[model samples]
Structures are given as structure tokens and as C-alpha cells.
Target: MTAPEDDAAGALAGTPEEQRAALERWRLVLGEPGQSVLAGGQLSEAGAGRDAALDWLYGRDEDLERRGVRQPRHGGDGPSVVTTVDWLDDITTLFPKETIERLQRDAVERYEIHDVVTDPAVLARIEPNPTLLKAVLRTKHLMNPDVLLLARRIVEAVVRQLVEKLATEVRHAFSGARSRTASRFKVARNFDIRRTLRANLGRYRPEERKVYVETAYFVSRTRRHLDQWQVILLVDQSGSMTGSVIHSAVTAACLWGLPGVKTHLVAFDTAVVDLTADVDDPVELLMKVQLGGGTDIAKAVAYGAGLIEQPRRTILVLISDLYEGGSEHRLVRLVRDIAEQGTKVLCLAALDEDADPAFDRDMGRRLADAGAAVGAMTPGQLAAFVAEQVGR
Candidate 1:
């Protein structure tokens, strides 16, 4: 099985045999987790239709029952739901608390999530309704890239719901919302001695009320207006960020789904490819993208900056490994200029996709000084930041 490792080597080319061999090779990358899920009917059941060739992934083909399950196999019915669940868990951790609730709801209804997991209630609901199970299969993995481009369709139902919710929430919050006093700030204003003390007669003496208001003074919240903004997330399509790239791209797509917020995505390696239009169909966006090229942070950033005619309201997020094929200084200069232009510039040295260090510390520091903060952001943190930045 390991011998097939070479198959994942070449690009998306070659004959049937080579393609099959390549699928097998990439399948090897799945290791045990990949096998467990794929072996359990994930391919055809959850991974078919999009790209027929993608069906070749991980020994999963037409009839899963034919080969039989393997390695601690305990199948009461259907393949293991662990893979999809695990992916969901990862994505769950990437969103904010409010967003997570929304995501959970989306997963449950849109993906028919209850049916996909080995839960009895879900099985009962779908046992009578076949369409329910079909829906479940569609949204099994919203954040996994290895599932092949074809399998991505299953994610649309849930993703669309989630994206719409997030986009709408964020867009409305950013574009239409007026600054409201924060809860803490509200607490502060409400704690005026004259107001609270008047309500609480003998229960609160002047000193007591003073202590109360002063003690609660820590809640000095001010009105931090939710501002309207446009964000362009440029993801590095290089192999390193493959997992994160997929997740972030989907995140970017969801942003595009909303009104008001101008979300643009440009994936890069040696050359820059503006994926703004492709956000409408993430699968096509990804298919159109071919990973593995030299990193050119400057080119990618500069391209994004050019798209922003009005910089002050623009939020530019560069998700990359930070290696550069182009001149590092030019990239630094571009970042500085964008910051000077009043763009809310930020560079994520590496989106929480992979954990291989590929950034230039000196360059990262320079960008930081230019007002572009750099750090790794978990998916949830990224989501929260996006929401907060846009006033969601």
C-alpha cells in the first residue's frame, strides 16, 4: 500500500492506470484515519459524483461491502461517521460561540447531520425518508479537502446555510449597524448612583451605592462602533496550506455570499490568480486552482492591494507560509503602503491549516511594524475576528 505513495506525486494528469495509481498514492497519505473512513463507504456514499476519478480515492469504489471492513471493524450499519464528525469538530472549534450554535443548527438541518452520525434518533428519522439520508451524505465534510472535489457538493447545503447566516450577520452588523453600547458599557451607564440608588432605598446607602458603582466601574465599556469593511483573503495554494487553504477559501466564499462586504479571494504560488469571481462556486475555484508553486507574498499582496480603490475600509488578510519568490523588500514595501493607505492590513503567517514554519521572521516583524499584525489563527478565531472586524 505504501508503494503507491509515488502515485500522489504527479499533477492531475496521466491515463486511467496512472490516475488510479495516483489516487492510491494520495490515499496512502490518509494513513489509518483515511482508510477507516474511506473503507466504510465514504467514497461512493459521500464522495462520488463531483469528480468520478476522485472516487478512486482510498480503495473506495462501487461496492464497499464487497471488500469488507477492516482494522477493529465494528459495523452495525453503514461506514464509520468518525471522519466527517472529526472534520466537523475541527471546523466547530474554528468558529465563535454564536457562530458555532449557528453551525450546529446548519449541520443538523442542512447536512441531516443527525442521520450521518451513528445516532439512533437520526437513523429513525431517515430510515423512512431516503432523501434524508441522501442529504446527510451531501454535507458530511464541510472542511475537509482530501475528500476530492466531487464530494464537496455534499457540503453546499450546510455551507450555504452557514455562509448565508454568517455573511448576513456580519454584513448587516458591519454595513447597517450603528454603534451600540457594549454590555459592560451598558452596565456602567446603568449603574449611575442616582439611578440605582434611587431604586434601592435603604438597601443601598450612599457609601454602599458608591462602592457598588465604583466596584462595578471595571465595566467601563465604550461604544466601539461596528464599522463597514471589505476584506480580501488571499490564500496560499501551495501544498503546505492545502488543508487550511481549503477551509479559508470556503470561509472567503461564505464572506462573498453576503451583501455589502466585498470579499475577494486570490490564491497564489509563483503566480497570482484572483479567485474573487470563483467564490460563487468554491469547487470550481479549487478545481481551477493548481497547488504547488514557489511562494510570492509580494505579488499576492500587491495584487490584492490594487483591487482596493478605497483602502481605509478594506481589510486585507494574507494567509500564507511567508516564503517569497519575489523580492521580500518589495513585499514589505507593498504591505507598508497598503497600511499607509489606511487598509486594515493583516497577515496570517500561516492559517491554522498546517504546522510547518515557512515564514521569514524578519519580514513578518517588518509587516507587524507597518500595522499588519501576523499570527496563526484557529478557524474559530479567524471566524470571530472576521465577525468582530465586520461588526457581527
Candidate 2:
């Protein structure tokens, strides 16, 4: 009759039997460390199976003995990597989906898997998720020419898939904006049927049951606005933003392809690299991104401002954690100046799928007070926001 949460709490803090059972479960998950909780306790056969699976992931006793090493030293490699494919496959069966994902991420960080992922055998053996994919792209600078090319292919595939998923909604939102009503004097191809009906109601011949059409309602023909609006995707390429960098690159490419919008992507980390020329190719654009460096956000903001020829027709999207390494006062001043000049500025705390991101709330508030909209959003949501902005 107890709720699952209550059952869980009972297992951990209930009767002695229940506590012992829960301790056995912990031993399975925490391995050697967990064994201390159940030092004199024993597990049932089923519990033993669970313990073995946990040991497979967290236990390093056997691995240490074989490799003749303890834990990894600072800036040094681990004793020996547990093969990614084997570990992931095993954990996938044993753990819940979220737990499996967490374990996989841990394994990646623990094993330095990105360095070897380019190998044909390794690439073929594992399923690459977003986190791993981001890691691969992040390490492109260290890869050889051949391996780098393979990494680009992987990035392109992932980006292409995202584009496919987002293309329809983006086009729809953008097209809806271009469907503005034409002036009454100038007959647009799109007919204003309701308006025409209202204007001609007086001319309705009730006796004959005929409404005479003195004026024809012609719908305005669809117009494509190529290079009419400018979109600047100013991304922060610091160490913590690797995932954001990858997704932002792909989103920038999508924005670039949309008619009537000229998209410019500038990635910053103390230095700015304008990848506008390669905007059409997300793969190439992402390859040029350098992930770890100090952040000079004010300078990047200044550079982005310089690109705006017409502030009224531009949208500046600044993606970052908002930990400004440069002058905060100057950054605030610049943002306020741009907003006052009629530029539509949006400061995204992050542009990744993770809902809760660690960002500077104080800075976000300051930017918002200065007329910038600040929040964390996924790429798809960002595309939707862009579509809404352009549509207006």
C-alpha cells in the first residue's frame, strides 16, 4: 500500500531486514566502497547478480592488478580502458536509461575515448550519442588529417539529421511572417476574403440573394525575402560549452539557409573566429571552433556589433554561460547600446537540451534589464524563437 518513494525510503531506513537488503543493493552499485555498508551481510542470488553488474562498471581491483597500476595520475592515462562497446552494452542491459547514459558519459571521461573513436573498429563498435559526438568534435584539433575527416563526416551526419527535423517548422514560422497583409489600394495576390466581405456587405442584394462584387479580393503572391534580415550567432567556445558549440553550429547553418536572413557565426574564447564564410557547411564551421580558452565576451559583442549595418533589421543571439572574462561594465554598456539602437538582442544562457544549466544569473538579469531576453533553450526551441522573431 506504500508509494514507490515510501517503499524506497522504507528499504533504506525501515526495519533491519529491509536496511540489510538495501545495503546489498548499494554494494552492487558502489562496488568496493559499498561493500563496507554490508561488511558482515550477505546477498541473495538475485542480489549477487546485481552486485556483479555493478562491479563490472565500478570495480577496478582486477584491472589494477593486471595493468600494475592504481588510479590515474594527474594528466596521465588510466591503467587500462574498459572497452566502450562492451561496457555500454553491459550497462545498457543492467541500468535504467538515464543511469546508463550517465555511466556512458563517465566511461568516456574516464577512458579518454575521443582519442580512439576515430578508429574504424572503435567507430563501428559503439553507438555515438550527443555527448560523445560533442566530445569527438571538441577534440578535432588533436586528430590527424584522416581521422579529422572521419570526424567531420560524423558531425555532418548528426547536423544533417537535426536540420531535417527542424527544417519544416523553421520554414513554416519564417514563411508565416512573410505573409503580411497588403494595403487595400495595392491588391496583393493573397485575397483578404473577410475584409472584402465586410466592405461589400452594403452592396448585398438581399432580394436577389446576390452579393455584387465591386472589388475583387486577390491574395498576395508568396514572396521570398533573401538577405533581408541579418542574424548573428555569437557563441562562447569555452571548455564548459562544448555541447552548445556543436548544436549552435548546426543551428547557425539552418539559419543561414533560410531565405532573407544572412547568418553570421562568431565563436569566441578570448579570440574571435568568424566562421561566416563556412556558415553553409556546419561541419567545416564546427571544425574551425577552438573549445578551450579565456572568454572575452565584451570584445566578441563589439565584433558582433560591428557586423550590424542596419540595427533595425538585425537579430543578435549571444550564446554563453555569461561568465565574462573581459570587462563586465563594457559588456553591459555594449548590450544596452545595441538594444537602444533598435537591434533585437537575445542572450541564451545555453543552447543545449539540458534544461538546468550553470550560468551567471546576475549577468542574465543585467542583460535582461538592458532589453535582452535571457534563458536556456534547446536548438529546436531556439529555431522556433528565431522564426517567431522574423515572422514579426
Measured by TM-score, the strongest candidate is: 2
By lDDT, the best candidate is 2
lDDT of 1: 0.57
Query: lDDT tens digits, residues 99-186, model 1?
Result: 4444444555544444333443333222112132223333333424443333334344434544555455444433432233323454
User: Which regions in candidate 1 have their CA more than 4 angstroms from the true location?
Assistant: 1-228, 353-358
Error of 2 at 303 (Å): 0.8
**Scored by Cα lDDT, where does model 2 land?**
0.74
Q: Using Cα atoms with residue i matched to residue i, what is each candidate's TM-score against the true structure? A: 0.49, 0.69
Off by over 4 Å in 2: 1-53, 60-100, 110-120, 178-227
lDDT scores for all predictions? 0.57, 0.74
For model 2, residues 1-392, the per-residue Cα lDDT tens digits are 75433454455767777776776666665554444456555677767655655555555445755665445334447445445456555665666777766665655566555644556455554455665677676677777788776666667777777667666656665665435555544545357778778789889998999878787664443445544778898999998888788778878877886766778999999998898999788777777778898999999999999999889989999999999999999999999999999999989878876745679999999999998988888887877677755555
